[model samples]
Target: MVSAVPECGGPGDLPAPRIVTDLAHGGRWTSLTAGGREWLWHRDEPRRAGVGPGDPFADAGGLEECVPTVRGTPDHGDAWSRPWRRAGEEESVDCPDFRLTRRVSAGAGRTVVDYRLTAAPGYRFLWAAHALLEVSGRARAVMTGG
Candidate 1:
C-alpha cells in the first residue's frame, strides 16, 4: 500500500505522485515519486549474492537463524517470496511465525509508511527495515549503534 501526492511542478511532471509496490517480493516498494522525482533505489537486475533488486527484506536480519530448522524457512525468510493480500491502501502477509502488514498514506509534502508485525508469544526474533533510497551518482552509508 503506497500512495503519494503530487506537488506543483513544471512540464513532464506527473499530475500526481505515486508509489508502486511489489507484493510478491517482500511487499517491497519498488517505486516512489514526489515532485516527479523517483526516491527509492532499484536496479534493473540483481547485482549481488543473497539479494535481488528492490528487495525490502534483503537479509532477513537473523530471523531465519532464530527460528527452528523444522520450519524450513529460507535464508532471507518467507516475506521475500510470499504473495501478499491487498485491501485498499494496505497489504499484508501471514508467515509461519508471524504476520506483517504495511500501509502507506500521502500528505502535503511527504508519504508515510506504517508497518505492523505480530508473532506468537515467546517467539524471539530479530527484524530490520531494509529500505534503501537512491541518490544521484555515488552515495555512502554510516551505521551507528550496537
Candidate 2:
C-alpha cells in the first residue's frame, strides 16, 4: 500500500488527513487523498529502481517535477532521476547548474507544495509540474475565485 499519514490522530484517534511521497525515488508525491478519494494516477506494476539522464521514460505515474528543460538532451531534466536532500518539510536536489528545492505543507483539506530554484545570475532553466490526475467519468471540477 502507498505510505500515508497515520490514520490515528492526536488523542482522539480520529482519521487524519493523508498524503504520500517517495523521497528517495525522485522525491515525487505518490498519492493524494481527500474525502476518502484518491486524486493521483499511479502505476499498478512495480516501479523501476531508478531513472537516469537519457534513460527511457519512467511512466511510474503520480506527480513528478521536471526541471531544466523537459524535452532536451537529458530527457526529463535532472531532478526526477536523482535522490534529494531532505530538511524537515523541504527537499532539495542539486543539478549540474542549479539547485531545485520544494517544500510541502498540509492544512485542512489542501496540500501545498512550494518550489524554489537557485542558480548563478544569468543562468536560465525551465521547470514544470508533471502531475497526473485520476478522474472518473462522473467526476466534476469545482472552480472558485476566478
RMSD of each: 8.0, 3.9
lDDT of 2 by residue, 1-146 (tens): 12344333433444445668777777677887766788899885344455655566587888888888788857777778777777766778887889898876655444566899999999888898888899989989899995
Residue-by-residue lDDT tens digits, candidate 1, 14-116: 3344666766545656676765577676665442224542344343221111112213445445565565678877778777778877786655444566877
- Stretches of candidate 2 off by over 4 Å are 1-17, 44-47
lDDT of every predicted structure (CA atoms):
0.55, 0.73
Query: How does model 2 fare in lDDT?
Result: 0.73
Q: In candidate 2, which residue pairs clash?
A: none
